[model samples]
Target chain A: MLVARGVTVAIKGKTLLQDVDLSLSPGQVLAIVGPNGAGKSTLLKAMTGERKTTGGEIELDGRALWHWTTAALASRRAVLAQSTEVVFPFLVSEIVTLGIRRNLTAAEQYRLVQRALVAVDMSTMSDRVYGTLSGGEKQRVQLGRVLAQVWSHGCTYLMLDEPTSSLDLSHQLLILRLAREHALSGGGVLMILHDLNLASMAADEIVALKDGNRIASGAPVDVMTDDLIAALYGVRVQVRGVPDGPFLLPQTARLPG
Target chain B: MSAGGVAMPAGTGAASARRGGLMLAAGAVLLVAAIVAALAIGPIFIAPADILAILADAAHGIRPTEGIAMRDAVVVLDIRLPRTILTALVGATLAVAGAVLQGVFRNPLADPGLVGVSTGAAFAAVLWIVFGGMVGAFLPQAVLAFALPISAFLGSLISTVLLYSLATREGRTSVAMLLFAGIALGALAAAGTGLVIFVASDQQLREFTFWTLGSTGGASWFKIGIALPFFAALFVGSFWLARGLDALAIGEAEAFHLGVDTQWLKRLAIVLVAAGVGAAVAVAGVIGFVGLVVPHLLRLSAGPMHDRLLIGCALAGGALLLLSDIVARTVAVPAEVPIGVVTAIIGAPYFLYLVHRNRAALGG
Candidate 1:
C-alpha cells in the first residue's frame, strides 16, 4: 500500500499542493481527477517521492518512502512520468530493457522485455528506433518500460500521471484495463486522469482535487455526483448511476456570464 | 492481430548486438593496421618485417649488433615506438573523454575541445611554460617535472565544473546553455593564453606556438610513463561509467528512477576527462577532432550502448589519431604540419555536418 497524509508542496513561496491525503491499497485502482492547476500531478509527484512535501509524509508498504534506497524502491515500485523523451536512437526493445534493473539471466531479461512489449501492443515495432515513433506509440512504449520495471516484483505500486493523455480512445481503455488488471493481481495502481468517465469505469475509488485541496474522495458512486463535479470543475454536468459505476454527462455545460 | 503478416524477425536486439560486436572487431583491426603503418611508413622507412623483429627482439632483451639493422632498431624502438604508443594512448583518452562528455551532456556536439576543456588545459600549460622559472625555484626537481600536467589537469577540472553548473538548473541540463557557455569558456581561455603569449620571449613564443598547434614530436619514454596512469584512470572510470551513461540518455530523472546515481556519475566523468585530457595536452599539446570525430563515427556504426561504445571509441580513436599523426609527420616532410591542423581539417567539416543534421533538435 502507498499512502500520503496531509501532503503539502510549496516551491519558492508558492504552494502547489496543500493538505492532500490519499492512499492506494493492494487490489485497488485509485484515480485522481481535477482540472489543470488543481494539484493532480503535484499530488502524484509527491506520492511517487519525486517531489518533497513541504508538510506531511508519504509511506510505502508501511515504511517511510525516503527510508528505501533508490534501487530497492525501484524494484518495489515504478513511476511513469507525464512525459519522457529518449535522447538517443535507442531501439524500442532497448528502451524497455532499460527498465529492468534485476540481475536476471539473458533469457529471462529477453522474456521480460517481450512480455512488456506484448502487453503494450508494441511487440511488432520492437526493433524501430524510439525517436521515430508516433506520440501515442511512444507513450505506449514508455508504458511498457514502466510495466517491465515491476513485472515480476510482487506487491509493487504503479504510479502513472496521465497515462492516457497521448493515447487514443482504444489505447486509453487498453491502458486503464492494464492498470485494473495489475490491481486485481494484488498490486496497487495510482493514476491521475482527466476523463471523469474513464476514471468512473476503471477506478475503484475516485479523488477529486480543487486548488490544492481534496474536494472529495470515495468509491466512484459517491464521488462522481453532479453537484461535486460542478463545484470541482465549475461546469454543469449530469451524473447517471449505472450498474458498474456512475457515468458523467456534460452536455449542458455553460460558462458563467 | 496480423502478426503473421508482419514477418517480425526474432531477436532484432540480438542482431544489433551482433553488429556492435562486428564493429568493435573492425575497429580493433583498424587500430592494429594504423599502428603498423605509423611505425613502418615514417621518414626512416623501416620495413614492417624488421619492425616486428625489432619488437620481438626487444621483448626478449636483444639488441641489433651493427649496420642498418642497428640504425633501424634505433629509429623503430627509440624514435617511432614511443611516439606511436603516445599517439594511440592520447587518441583513446580524448575519444573516451568526448564520448563521456556527450553522454553527460546528452548531446552529440559535446566534445572536450568544443566544451573548453582542452582550451582551459592549454591555457594552464601556457601559464606554466611562461612562468615556471619563478615557480620552479621553490619546487623540487621531481615536482617541477609534473607541474605542467598537474596544472593542466586542474584547469580542465575547473572548467568542466563550471560548465556543468552553468548549464544545469534544478538537476536538468539545458543543451543550448551548455554549448553557449562552452563557447564563452573557450574564448576566455584563449584570451588568457593570448596574454601569456604576449609576455613570452621569441624562443618561448615559438615553443608555445608548436604546443598550441599540437604535436607528438617530443614523445619520449619518460613522457609516456607520466601519461600512462592517467590513461589507466580514464579507461577504468569509463568502464565503471558505461551503464550509468547509457541510463543517462533517457534524462536525469528517468535515470534516477532506474536507480542510477547520476550526480556521482557526472562527477566521476568530469574528473576522468580532466585527468585524461590534461595529460594528453601536457604531452602532445592541444590536438583536436580525435575526441569529437572518433566517438561520433563509432556511435553511428556501433549503436549508442556505452559499454561497447567506450571500447569502440578507444580502438577507433587510437587508430584515427595514429593515422592523423602519420599525416602530420609526412604531409610537408621536414616542415611537418601540426597534428591539430590535420585533425581540424578533417573534423571541423564533420562537426558542421552534425550541426546541420541536428538543427531541428538544436532548435528545440
Candidate 2:
C-alpha cells in the first residue's frame, strides 16, 4: 500500500499541492481527476518520492518513502511520467529492456521484454526505431517500459500520469483494461485521468481535486455528481448513473431559455 | 498476431548485437593496421618485416643480431614504439571521453575539445611549463615531474563541473547554453594561455608553442608511464558508466526511475573525461576531434548503445589518432605539422556538417 497524508508541496513561495490525503491499496484502482494545474501530477509525484512534500509524509508499505533506496522502491513501484523524451534512436525492444532492474540472463531479459511489449500490444513493432513511431505508439512503448519494470513483482504499484493522453480510442480502452486487470491481479494502480467518463469506467474510486485541494473522494458514483463536477471544474454538467459509475455530459446554458 | 505478418522472435536484438560485435571486431583490425602503418611509415621507413623482427627481439630482451641496422632497431624500438603506444593511448582516452560526455550531456555535439575541456587543461599545463622553476625549487624532483599532469587534471575537472552547472537546469541540459558557455570558456582559456606565454623565456616559449599545437613528437616511455594510470582509470570507469549512460539517454528523471543513480553517474563521467582528456593534453597538447569525431562515426556505423559504443570508441579513437599522427609526421616531411592540426583539418569540416544537419535542433 502507498499512502500520502496531509502532503503539501510549495515551490518558490507558490503552493502546488496543499494538505491532500490519499492511499492506494493493493487490488484497487484509484483515479485522480482535476482541471489543469489542480496538482494531480504533483500528488502522484509526491507519492512516488519524485517531489519532496513540504509538510506531512508519504509511506510505502508501512515505511517512510524516503527511507527506501531508489532501487528498492523501483522494485516495488513503477512510474510513467506524463511525457518522456528519448534523444537516442534506440529500438523499441531496447527501450523496453532499459526497464529491467534485475539480474536476468540475456534470454530471460528478452522474454520479459517480449511479454511487456505483448501486454502493450507492441509485439509486432518490436524491431522498429522508437524515433520513427507515431505519438500514440511512443506512449505505448513507454507504457511497455514501465510494465516491464515491475513485471515479476507481484504486488507492485503502477503510477501513471496521463498515461492515455496521446493514445487513440482503442489504445486508450486497452490501457484502461490493462489497469483494471492489474488491479484485479492483486496489484494497485494510481492514474491521473483527464477523461472523467474513462475514469468512471475504469477506476474503483475517484478523487476530485480543485485549486490543489481534494474536493471530493469516494466511489465514482458518489463522488462524480453534477454539483461536484460543477465545483471542481466550474462547468455545469448532467451526471447520469450507470452500473459502472456516473457518466457526465456537459450541458451549456440551454440557449438562454 | 492480429496482423498478417509473422511475429518477431523473442531474441529480436540478437541480429543487431551480432552486427555491432562484428563492427567492433572490424575496428580492432583497423587499429592493428594503423599501428603497423604508424610504426613502419616514419621518415626512416622501416619495413614491416623488420618492424616485426625488432618487436620480437625487443620482447625477448635481446639486441637485434640479424639484417636489421642498429639505427633501424633504435628508430623502431626506442623512438617509434613509444610514440605509437602513446598515440594509441591518447586517442583511446580522448575518444572514450567524447563518447561518455555525449551520453552524459544527452547531446551529440558534446566533446572535450569542442567544449573547452582540452583548452582548460592546456592553459594549466602552460602555467606549469612557464612557472615550474619557481615551484621546483622546493619540491622533490619526482613530485615536480608529475606537477604538469596533476595541474592539467585539476584544470579539466574544474571546467567540466563549471560547464555542467552553467548549462543544466532542473536536470535538463540546454544545448544552446552549453555551446555558448563552452565558447566563452574556450576563449577565456585561450586568453589565459596567451598570458602565460607572455612571461615565458624564449626556450619555454618555443617548447610551449609546440605543446599548444599538439604533437606526439615528444612521446617517451617515461611520459607514457605518467599517463597510463589515468588512462586505466578512464577505461575502467567508462564501462561502469555504460549501462547508466544508456539509461540516461531517456532523461535524468526517467533514468532515476529506472534505478540509475544519475548524480553519481554524471559526477563519475565528468571526472573520467577530465582525467583522460587532461592527461592526453598534458602529453599530446590538445589533439582535437578524436574525442568529437570518433564516437560519432562509430555511432553511425555500430549504434548508440554505450557498451558497444565505448569499446568501439577505444579502438576507433586509437586507430584515428595513429593515422592522424602518421599524416602529421609525413605531410610536411621534415617540418612535422602538429597532430592537432591534422585532426582539426579532418574534424572541423565534419563538425560543420553536423551543425548544418542539426540546425533545427540548435535553433531552439
Candidate 3:
C-alpha cells in the first residue's frame, strides 16, 4: 500500500496542494478528478517522489519515501506523464526494452518488451521508429512502455497523469480497462482523469479536488452526485447510471436565489 | 506491417518511417573504404602500390626495392602516418562528442566545438601559454611543457559543468536552454580568447592564430599516441551507452522513469564530450563542424540508432577529416591550407541548409 500524510507542496512560492492525505491499497483504482490547475498532477508528483513535499511525507510499506534510493523507488512504482517526445529515433522494441534497465537480463528484457507491445496490441509495430508514429500511436506505445516498466520491476503502484488525453475514445476505454485489469491482478492504479463519467465508470474510489483542496473522497457511487457535480464544476450536469458505466451530460446552469 | 517500413501502432495516425538496413550497411562500408582512400591520398600522392609496399615492409620487415630510399619509408611511416592517424582520431572524437551531446540535450544543433567546449579549452590553453611564458625564466622546463593542455582540459570540464547547471531546471535539462546557454557561453569564451590574442605579442599571437586555424601541418607521433587511446576509450563508452541513449531518444523524463538514470546518462555524455573535446583541441586546435556534419551524414543512413550512429559517425568523421586534410595539402601543394578551413567551407553551407529545412524541428 502507498500512503501520503499531510503532504503539503509548494513550488516557486505558490502553494500547489495542502495537507493532502491519500492512500492506495492493493486492488484499488483511485481516480483523481479535478479541473485544470487543481493540483492533481502535483499531488501525483508528490506521491511519486518526482516533486519534493514541503511538509509531511509519503509512506510506502510504513517507511518514509525519502529513504528509498531513486532505483529503489522506481522499482517500487511506475509513472507515466502526459506526453513524451524523443529527440533521436529509436525502434519501439528497443525503446520498450529500456523499461527494464539494469534489472533484467538482456534476453529477459527483450521478451518482456515484446510482451508489453503485445499486451498493448502494438506487437506488429515492434520495429517501428518511435518518432514516425502519430499522437495516438505514440500514446499506446508509451502505455506499453509504462506497462513494461511496471512489469519489469513489479511495481505495486502505477501513477498515470492524463494518460488518455491524446487518445481517441476507443483507446481511452482500452487503457482504462487495462488499468482495471492491472489493479485486479494484484496491482494498484492512481490515475488523474478529467472525464468524470470515465472516473465514475472505471474508478472504484474517487477523490475530487478543487483549487488545491480535497472537496470529497469516497466510493464513486456515493461521492458522484448531481448537486456535487453542479457545485464543483459551476454548471449543471445530469448523471445516468447504466449497466456498462455512468454517463454525464452538461445542462444549462441555474443559480440559487 | 510494412515491407520496408515500420508500421504505426494503434493510435499513431500514420505509417512508421523505416530506413532500409541495406542502405545503412552500404553507407558504413562505404565510409570505411573512404577512410582507406584518405590514408592513401596526400601531398606526395603515394600510389596504392607504393602505399602497400611501405605498409607491408613496415609490418613484415620486408624492405622495398633498392631504388626506394630509406627517406621515403621514414617519410611515410613517420610523417604521413602520424598526421593521418591524428586527423582520424581528432575527427572521430569531435564527431562522437557532437553525437553524444545531441542525445544528451535532445538537440540536433549540438556540436562539441561550436558549443563552448573548445572555447573553454582555448581559454585555459591561452592562459597557461601566457603565464608559462611569463614565468619561463624561473620555472623548471618540466612545468612549462605540461601546463598548456592540462589547463585546457580543466577549462573544458569547468565549462561543461557550468553549461549543464545553467541548462538544468528542477533536475531536468531543457534542450532550448542548453542550446541558448551553450551559444552564449561559447560566444563569451571565444570573445575572451580573441581579447587575449589581441593583447599577446605578435610572435605568440601568430602561434595562437595558427592554432585556432587548425592544421595537421606540424604532425607529431606523440600527439597521435595520446589521441588514439582517448578516442578509442570514448568510442567504446559511446557504443556501450547506445541503448541508454536510445531510451533518451524518446525524451528524458520517460527514460528516467524507465530507470535509465537520466541525469547520470547526461553526466556521462558530458564527460565523454569533455574527454573528446579536450583531447582533440589540445592535439589539433579547434577544427570546426566535423562534429556536426559527420553525424548528420551518418544519421541519413544509420536510422538514428546511437549504436549504428556512433560507429558510423566515427568512421565517416575520421574519413572526412583525413580526406579534408589531404585536399588541404594537395590543393595548396607546398603551402598547405588549414584542414579546418576545408571542413568549414564544406560543413557551413550544409549546416545552413539543414537549419533552414529543420527550422521548426529545432524550436522550443
Clashes of each: 0, 0, 5
lDDT of each: 0.85, 0.87, 0.76
Which candidate comes out best when scored by TM-score? 2
Report per-candidate TM-score of chain A alone. Answer: 0.97, 0.96, 0.93
Shift of residue A204 alpha carbon in model 2, Å:
1.4
Q: Please, what are the lDDT tens digits per residue for candidate 3 over residues A122-224?
A: 8888777788888888888888888988887888889999888888888889889889998999899999999887888889899998888788999887777
Candidate 1's residue-wise lDDT over B131-225, tens digit each? 87887899998888788788888888989999989988866677788889999998898789888888788676556555566899899999998
Best by lDDT: 2
Q: Please give the lDDT score at residue B322 for candidate 2.
A: 97
Give the lowest summed-lDDT range of ten residues in model 2 chain A.
A248-257
> Could you give candidate 3's per-residue lDDT for residues B111-196 as a string of tens digits?
77667877787777776666657766776766555555566667787888888789877545665677688888888877877888
Q: Lowest-lDDT window of 10 residues in candidate 3 chain A?
A: A248-257
Candidate 2 residue lDDT tens string, B141-234: 8887778888898889988898999989988888888888988897799789888887777787556555556899889999999988888999
lDDT of 2 by residue, A121-228 (tens): 998888778889998999999999998887854437999999999998999999999998989889999999999989999999999988899989999888877778
Give the higher-lDDT candidate: 1 or 3: 1
Interface RMSD, candidates in the order listed: 6.3, 6.2, 6.7
TM-score of every candidate: 0.94, 0.95, 0.88
Question: Distance (Å) between predicted and true CA of B65, model 2?
Answer: 4.9
Clashing pairs in 1: none
Q: Report fnat in order of the candidates.
A: 0.38, 0.45, 0.36
